[model samples]
Target chain A: MKNTYTDSGAKDTRSGFGAGLLELGRRNDRVVALCADLTGSLKMDGFKKAFPERFFQVGIAEANMMGIAAGLTIGGFIPFTGTFANFSTGRVYDQIRQSIAYSHKNVKICASHAGLTLGEDGATHQILEDIGLMRMLPGMVVINPCDYNQTKAATLAIAEHYGPVYLRFGRPKWPNFTPEDQTFEIGKAITLVEGKDVSIFATGHMVWMALQAQKLLADRGIEAEIINIHTIKPIDREAILNSVAKTGCAVTAEEHNRYGGLGDAVAQVILTAHPVPQEYVAVNDSFGESGKPEELLAKYGLTPENIAAAAVRVMERKKH
Target chain B: MSITKDIKELEAWLPQVRRDIVRMVHAVQSGHPGGSLGCTEFFVALFQYIMDHDPKKFTMDGRDQDIFFLSNGHITPVYYSVLARSGFFPIEELRTFRRINSRLQGHPATHEGLPGIRVATGSLGQGLSVALGAALAKKLNGDLHTVFTLQGDGELQEGQIWEAAMFAAHHKVDNILVTIDRNNRQIDGDVSDVMDLGDLKAKFEAFGWLVAECENGNNLIEIADALLLAKSLTRNEKPVVLIMHTEMGHGVDFMMGSHEWHGIAPNDEQLQRALEQNPETLGDY
Candidate 1:
C-alpha cells in the first residue's frame, strides 16, 4: 500500500519533546523532568514551568542526574532527563549502563542538540555517536523521530513504556511533516512514501532529506521507497525485510556517522533477511567541525542530492 | 539502655558474619573482604537494630520501611551475608555468590532479580544520588520513612558524590542517612595517598550536610547510637551524614592495618587463620 506525507512547516524537535513532557505532566502525576543546566536549550522550560515541584534542575551533573532519574523509577515516578546528546551518552554512559539499563530502571533519557546539525557550537557539543552507544546497551530503546509532531508523540509515548529509553533530537529547526495526533508505536518504522524501484531508509532529520531525494529520483524516472526508521534499537525488522525483499536493493541515510548509525542497522537487516546491495548517505568516519547546518550536511554528503545519488547507485547494483 | 539485651545478641552475631565475609570471598576466590569485615558491626547494627526494614518481604518501594543501599558494591560479601542472615533470601544462596546465573553478581544488580538491590552499583559515587531520589520519593509520598545508604571513603573521590551532596543539601533531603565506611583503604592504597580525600568531614560540612563522626564504627552500640542520633536530626530541612571510622579489617589480625586485603580473596590458610580470629559465634553459612 502506497503512503504519502506533506510537510506543514519547520519546527525544532526539542520543542516537540517539551510539548509532550508538559502533556505527560498533566496526564500522569508520576511524570518528572530533570535537566542538566540546559532547560532552555532542551526546551524543557515548559514542563518546569507547568510542574515546578516535579521538575529537577540537576545543574550540569549529568551522571548524578542519571542516577537520580534511575532511582525515581523505584518509587513509580517516570523521570525524563534532558541534556545535550554529548553529555547524555558519552558523558554519563556508565551511569546509564549501570544505573538505568542494567538495572532495567524506567528512565527516559531525552537528548537534544544531537549530530553535526548542532552547528556553530562545533564538535564538542555535537554528538553523532549517541544512537550507536545507546542502541548497543542491553535493553535501552533508542528513538530518533523525524520532526516536531512525532518527537512530541514519542516523548509522551515513552512515558507510558516501562523501561529505560534514549530519545534523541536535533538542534536545528527542521521540517515538521508527521501528523499531529499520530500514535507512536515503539519499534515500528514509518513509511513516509511508498515506491518499488529502490528502498531509501532514513531517520532523524535525514527523513526530510530522503523525502526530497525521493522527489529528485522520481524526476529521473526512479520510484524510490522512502521509509522513516525512527526506532533504531529493537528495529522494525519485519518492515525492513519486507521492503528490501520487494525492492531487492536499499539506500540508508542518517545525520550520524556512516559506521554505527542507521546504515549499519539497515545493513544487518538486509544481509540477514534479504542479502541486497545497499549504499549509505551518511557522514563517513570523521568528527564534525564548526560549520553552518546546510554546509555541514552538503560537506558530509548528507544533502537530498547525495541521497538521490546513492539511490541511483544502489538501483544499478540490483541485478534483475 | 533497653536494647542492652538486643545489643548483646547483635554483638554475638558479628563473628559469624565476619566468618561469612571471609569464607564467601575465599570460596569465590574473588570479592572484597577487608571493608566487609571492617563494616561488620555497621551492617549488624543496621539490619539488626538501627534501620527499620523487613527482609521477610523486601519490597523495593519500602513505603513504610527504612531502605539501605550498598553504594560501594565491592563489599557485597558483608551485604549479601547480612541480607541472607537477616532473611531477605535463603542463607544457602550465599554459596552461589559470583557463580554463573546466580542472583549474587560480582556487583550488586537488580538485573538478576536480586531482592535487596534497588539499583545496580559497582560504579562508585552514583548511589548517594539514588538514595537522595528515594528520599525525595519518600518525601513526596509522605511515607515519613527514612532512606539509608553506605559508601566507601574512597568512593568520595568521584565527582558525582559531591554533586549528589550539593543536591541533597540544596533540596534539603532531610529524611536520609549516608554512612561512609572510613576504613581509609582502597584498592591502590590508603585513600589519602591514592587521591587525598582531605578532611572528609569538613567537605561534607561545607556541602551543608549535618555531619556526625563516629570514631568507633565497629562498635555496635556506637553505630546504633550515632544512627539514632542522625534519625533525630532528620526532616529538619537538612541532610545528615555519619563519617564512620573503621579499620580495613577489624576482627582478623593480619588483614588489618594494610590495604592489601581490601579486594583480594584470602587463600585457604589465610581464610582459616581469619576464621580462627573470630571463632564462629552463630556458626558459618
Candidate 2:
C-alpha cells in the first residue's frame, strides 16, 4: 500500500484549475471564465489570454460576479467564476443563493486559496468555513480535490456537470500525487489504499496527510484504509458505508473547520446507518493567523502526525 | 411573435392588467401593488410591444430572443399579470400568487420551472449583473438579441448594483437595455426620505450609459416610445438605461402618490374602487 502512490511533482492546485480551464476553453466554446481582479492569483490568466472574448474581468466585485455568472447560464453558456474562497462564499452568499443555487444555474464557482493553506494572507483571506456555507445550499455541488492532477480533472468534470458547483482549491504547491488521466467523478469517493483496521477519510490537501498517516499507522501494525472524499455535498455514502462496515472505526481529515466539513458530513452518514467510532483531525473552532503553510498545518493539528494520532485514538475507542 | 406597435391595442391591456394587479394583491391580502400599478405600462410595453420575444416558445436559454429580468422582484403582481396576459403561463395560474404549492412564489423564481422568469430575484442589486451576463453571452454567441432588466429606484442603494453599473459601462456591454422603475417609493418610505438618489440620469451618464427618461411611465405610448428610443441607443458600444419616472400607485386613486401602499394590499371596498377606477377591459382571473 505504501508503494502504491508516489508524488509526481509539486504544483499549486490553482495552476491545475488554470490548465483545466484552458483545456475547457478549447474543448467547449460555451465555457466562459470570469475573475474578480485575481486573474493571476487564481491562475486564470492562461484561460483569459486564450479566450479573451469569453473571459470577463469583473474588477473586485464578488457579488456582481456571482450574479453575472448566474446570468451567463441563462444564455446556454457555462460560466466559471474565479475568486478566493472567502470572497467566493461569504461575500456573495445572498447573490449565490438567490441567483445561482436557487435558480439552479449552470455556473462553476472555482475558488482558490482555501483554508489555512492560503498562508500569510491570514484568516480574512483564508476561509475555513466555506465548505459549510457552500454545502448547506440546496443543489450546490461542493468539491475540494486533493492535488494538481485531481483538481484539473475535477475542473473539467464539473463543466460537464450541469448545475451550481463550488470547486475549492489551495494556493501553495503541495505534493501532486493523483494520476493525470484519472477520471474525476463528482460524488464517488476514490479508495486510495486498501486496509481493514481503520478507515481514514480525507479531502482536499488532507488526502496527502492521510496517506502519510497510513504509512505511520502501518509501521505500528495498524492497517488503515485511505479514501478520498472530495465532493462534500452528495457525499459518497455507499463508499463510506462499505468502507466503515469493513473497518469499525474512522478518522475524517480536512483543513476545514471541524463543525461542518467532511467530518460532519461523514459523521451524519455514519450516525444514521452504521454507528462507528470516529475522530476529527481538523481546525477546531478558532481563526488562523499568517504563517508558513507547513507551520499553520502543524499549529492547527492538520499534519500527518495529528492524523495518525486521531486514527489511533479512534481505533482505541473502537476497541472498547 | 410580432411586436405590437399599436398603442391602442397595448393600452387596452393596461386597465385589465391594473385590475389584475390590485385584485391579485387584494386576494392575497399581501404584495406590492404600488410599484405593480406604477410599472403597468412599462411591463405592457416590454412584453406586448417593445421586446422581440416569444412567450409561447419560452425556454430557459432564451437564445436569439430578447429577454427581460425583473430586478425588483417584489412587484410580482405586475410581473405575473403581464407574463400571464402575455401567454407565458396559463392566466388561471395567477390565482396561485403567493399561495402554498403555487408555481408563483412571493417573488418571481425559476425554481418552480416558471416560464418567462430566467432568474430568481427578490434580492435587490443582483438582477442587473445577471442581465449583463446574459448580454455578454449574446455577444459571445454573436446573437443579435438584446437583454433587458428592470430595477427599482431604491434598489440602486445596493452596492452590487453600482458594481454592475460600473462593469456594464466599462465593458461596453452595448446589447443591454436596463430600465429603472423610478417609482420614488420603497417598503420603508419614499426613496428620497430613506436614501436620496440624487440626479440618477446624470449618475448613469457618468457611468457611461446612454440614459433616456420617460416622464410618465403609466402612459403606454410614452413607455413604448421610450423603449424604442432605448433600443435605438443600443449597438453603439454603450449600454442603455431608461429612467422611467412613475407614481408609486398610478391608477388606483386612493393608493396613488404614497409609499404607504408600497407593500400593503388594498381592502375589499378599496379593491372595488381601484377596479372601478380602471374598468376591466379584459376578463379577470
Candidate 3:
C-alpha cells in the first residue's frame, strides 16, 4: 500500500458537497435540494441556481425541512436536505426518526459545519454527538468523509443508494489529499498507509491529523497504519480487525466526542472479535468554545501530536 | 373531483366503520378510539366517496392519485377501517389492530409495508410538510393530483405545524389540502384547558391559506361538502385548510363530546352499548 499522500490543495468539504449536488442536478432530474435558511453556508447555491424549480428553500425550520424531504421521496424525488450539522441532526431528530428513518424514506441529510472545526460558532453550532445520534437510528447511514474529494464522491454515491443517509462534513478549508476520481463505496474503509506497529483508525478531519501523526510516529521508528473510516454506521469491521490483527494495538481519532464517535465504533468491533489495546484521540466529553478551528482542535487534544501520543500509549498497553 | 358514490351508500359504511373502530380498540384493550370515532365521517367521505385512488393497486409513490397522510396517526382505527373497507387490504386485518406482528400498528406506520400509509406520523406536526412535499412531487412529475393531510387540533400546538404552515404559504404549495380535526379534546382534557388554539381559522388565513370550516364534522354531508370546497380552493396559488369542528366521540352516546375516552378502550358493556347505538350496516371485520 502507498505509505505517503501529497496534498494537492486545501478546500472546504461543504464546497465538495455543492459540486456533487450540482453535478447530480445535471445527471438526474429526480434529485432535489432543500436548505433551512443556510443555502450559502451549506454550499447549495450552485444546485439552487441550476435547478430553480427543484430546490426548496425552507427558511429556518429544520424539522419541517426533514419532513418535506421524507415526503419528497414518496413521489419518486430524491431530496437532499442541507443545513449545519447541529440543526440537521439534533434540532430535527424526532422529525428524522419518525418521518425519515422509521418511514424508511430515501432522503439524504447532508450536514455541514460539523465538530469544533465550525470555528467561532461555539458549541451551539458545532455538534460532536451527531454521529452517535444518526448511527443509532435503524437503517441510517452515517458518513463523515475525510476531505473535499471524498465528500463529493460520497454525495454522488449516496444518490445512487436508496435509503436514508446522514452525510456530515465541516466548515473549514482542510487538506485535499484523497483521489479526485475515487468511487466512494458505503461501509468501506480506505487504508491510507501500511505499517506493523499500530493501527490508527480515523474519520472526518481527524484522518488528516492521523496522517500527520503517522509521519511523526515514523520519525520515532513506529510504523503506524492509517485507515480512513468514512462511514461510521455499517462500519467496515473486517478492515478494523485485519489492521488490529497485524498491529496488536490501535488508536482511534475523530473530530467528535470520544464516547460515541469513531473510537467507540472501533472499540465495539475490537472487543467483540479481536481483543486489542486501543487509545482514543477525541474530545473528552466537553463542549467546544468559540475560537479559531486550529486553536480549538489543539486545545481539545485533537492534533497530530495528541494522536501520536495516543498511538505510543496504546502501543505500550499492547501485550507482548 | 366529484363524490362518485351515492351519499346514502357512503353513509351506509359509517356504522360498520364505527363498529370496527370500537371493536378494534376493545379487542386489543389498547388504542385511541375517540379521535377515530370523531373523524369517521371525514375518513369515510375521503376514502369511499371523494379520493381518486385505486385501493387494489397501492404504491408508495402514490403518483397520479390523491394521497392522504394521517399526521395524528393515533387515530389508526378509523384509517385502518376505511383502508380495509376501501380494499387497500383484507377487511379481516382490522382484527389485528395494535396486535403483535400486525400491519395495523398502534400508530399508523409505513414500516410494516401497510398499503395505504405513505409515511409514519405518530409524531405530531410533520404531516403537513410531508403532504406539501408530495404535492410538490406531483407538480414535478406533472401528475396534477392533489395531496391531502389530516391533523388533530391539538397537534397544531407542536411548533413544526406552524413552521409547515409558514412554509406552505411561502412556497405556494397550492396542490395540497390540510384538514384540522377540531375535536376540541386532547389527552389531558379539553384542548382549551391544555393549551388554547385561539382563532385557528384566522391563524391559517393569516398564514396565507384559503380556510374553510365544517360546522358539523360528524355529518357526512357537511364533511363531503367541506372536502369538495377545500379541494376546489386548491391550485389557486394558495394552500387550502378545512377547520372541521367535531365531537371527540361522535357515534357513541356515552363516549361522545368528552376527552375521557380519547385513548382508552371501551370495556365489554360499553362496547355493547356503543355497538347498539351504531348498528352494523356492512358486516363487522
Candidate 4:
C-alpha cells in the first residue's frame, strides 16, 4: 500500500498563530489584538508593529485584559486576547466566564504554551485543564489544532467566526504533518486514514503522535484509524461515532490530564453512542517537572509508543 | 427647587417621578425603591433638562446624542420611569415590571434588546469599563458626544471598579463622567459601617480624575451645575467623577434613614401613605 502520511518538517504552532494574526490585521480594521505582557512570547510583535493603534498591551493583568476585551466587543471590535495557557484559563477564568462567555461577547481567547510540552516552565506554567475549563462555559468554543499549518488556519478561522472562542496551541515545535493549504472548519474532525481494528482519536500536540502510532499499529498487524479532533467543545460527534462504528474499538490520546481533558471528552461521546473498549493515552494524576520538551512528552506517556501500546491494549479488550 | 424653571412647571413633574418609583415597585411587589427615590432628581434633570435624547428614536449607538449607563441597576424604577416619561416607550409598560416577557427586567439587560440600554450591567463594577470603552469608541469614530455613568457608592468595593478607574486614568479617558450615589446605604448596613470608603472624592482626585461634589443630588439645579462642571473638565486631561450626596429614600418617609429599605418594596398601605406625602403631580404608572 502507498504511504498515506507525510511529515513536512517540524515547527512550533505559535508561529502559525502569529502569521494568522498578522494576516487578520491586514484584512480587517475591526480586528484588534490584546496581550498581557507576553507580546514577544505570543509572537505578536508583527501585529503590534503593523497595527500599533489597534493593539492594546494590558501589562501583567490577565483579569483586566479579559474585561477590556469584553468591553472592546461592545464597540463592534473583534478582540483576540493572547497569554500563556495558565494565565488565560485558571488565572482569569471568572473574568472570561462573566465578561465574555456568560455575556456572549465576541472575544477570541488565544492561548499559547498549552500542555506539558511547554517544557522547562514546569507544571505551574503548563495548563492541562484549560480545555475543560473553557469547554464547561456555555456558548464558548474550544479549539486545539494539531500542527503549525493547522494552528495558523484555525487562528484565521476563529478571527472570522463570531462569538466567544478559546484557541489553544503549544510552545514546542512538532512535526508539520498537516497540509499547508488546508482550510479549517470549526467543530469538524479530519479523518487522516482508515482502518478496522481500532480508531485513534487525538488533538493538539498528540495528533502527530497518534499518526505515528497508526504506522506502528499497522506494522504489528493492528489496523488503526486516525481522527484529528481539533475542536473539543461543540465536538464533531458524527465523525467520532462513525469512526468508532467502523473500527469497533478506540483510543484517545492528548498531552493533558486524563481526568477532564480530550480523553474525557472523547470517552463521554463513545459511551453515549457505540460503547466500546477504549484506552486513554494521557498524563496520569501527576504534575510535570522541569525538563526538555521531548523528555517531558515521553515522561508524561504522550509518545507514539505509548499510543501504540494503548492501541494494543484496547484491541485486546475489544475481543471481550 | 433651586432650578430657574417656573415652580408650577417643576413641581408638577417631581412628584410624578416619585409616584412612578412607588407604583413601579408596588406593581412588581419586589423592586428597589430607596435608590430609585434617591436618584430621582438626577434622572429627572438628565432626561428633562440636560440630555438632548429622543425617546422615539433610542439608538444603541447614539452617535449624535449622549449616552447614559446605570451601573447600580437595582435602581431600575427611576431609570425605567425616566425613560418612559421621556418617551422611550409607552407608560403602560411600567406595569409589567419583572413580569415574564417584560422589557423591564429585575436587572437591566441588553439581551431583551431594550432600546435605552446599550449593555447589560447588573453585575457591579462593569459599567465604568463599558462606558470608558464607549467613550473610546466615540473618540475613534470622531464623534464628540460623551458617555455618562452612575454607580452606587457601595459598588465601589468591587475590584473591577479599581481596574476600570486605573485604566480610565491611564488612558486619559476624558469624555466620560462617572457619578457615585454616596447615599451611605447598602444591602448590609450603612456604607461607613459596612466598608468605609474613606474620602472618595480625594481618592478619585488621587487617581487622576477631576472630582466634583453635589451637595444636593436631589436638586435639579445642583445636578445641572455638577454636569456642567463635568463638561468643562472633559478635555484630554482626565475623567470626571461626581460624588453625589442624596438621601437613600429622599421623597419617601418610611424608606429613608435605614438601609433596610434599600431594595424592598412597600405594601399597599405604605404605598398609599407614601403617595399621599408626595402627591401625584403628573400621573402615576
**Clashes in model 1: which pairs?**
none
State the C-alpha lDDT per candidate: 0.90, 0.93, 0.93, 0.85
Off by over 4 Å in 2: A1-3, B1-5
Reference contacts reproduced by model 1: 0.70
DockQ of each: 0.80, 0.90, 0.88, 0.36
lDDT measured at residue B136 in model 4 versus the true structure, 0 to 100: 72
Across B1-285, the per-residue lDDT of candidate 1 in tens digits comes to 466677887878899999898989999899988999999999999888977778887776777888988899889999999999998898999999999989999889998887888999999988998888888878777788889999999999999999999999998889999999998999999988999999888888899999988999988998888878877888888899989999988999999999999888988999889888887877677
Instruction: Name the TM-score of candidate 2.
Output: 0.98
lDDT of 1 at A168: 96
Off by over 4 Å in 1: A1-4
Decoy 3 TM-score against native: 0.99
Q: What is the C-alpha RMSD of each candidate to the true structure, in Å?
A: 1.2, 1.6, 1.1, 2.8
lDDT of 1 by residue, A1-320 (tens): 44356778899999999999999999999999999899999998988998999999989799999988987887778899999999999999999998899989999999999999999999888788888898999989999999999999999899889899999998888989899999999999988888899999999999999999888988998888888999998899999998888888999999898888889999998898689999998889888989999999989889999999998888888875
List pairs with backbone clashes in candidate 3. none
Task: Give per-residue CA lDDT, model 3, range B178-219, as digits (tens).
Answer: 999999999999999999999898899899999999999999
TM per prediction: 0.98, 0.98, 0.99, 0.92
After TM-score superposition, the amount by which residue B92's alpha carbon in candidate 1 deviates from its true location, in angstroms, is 0.5
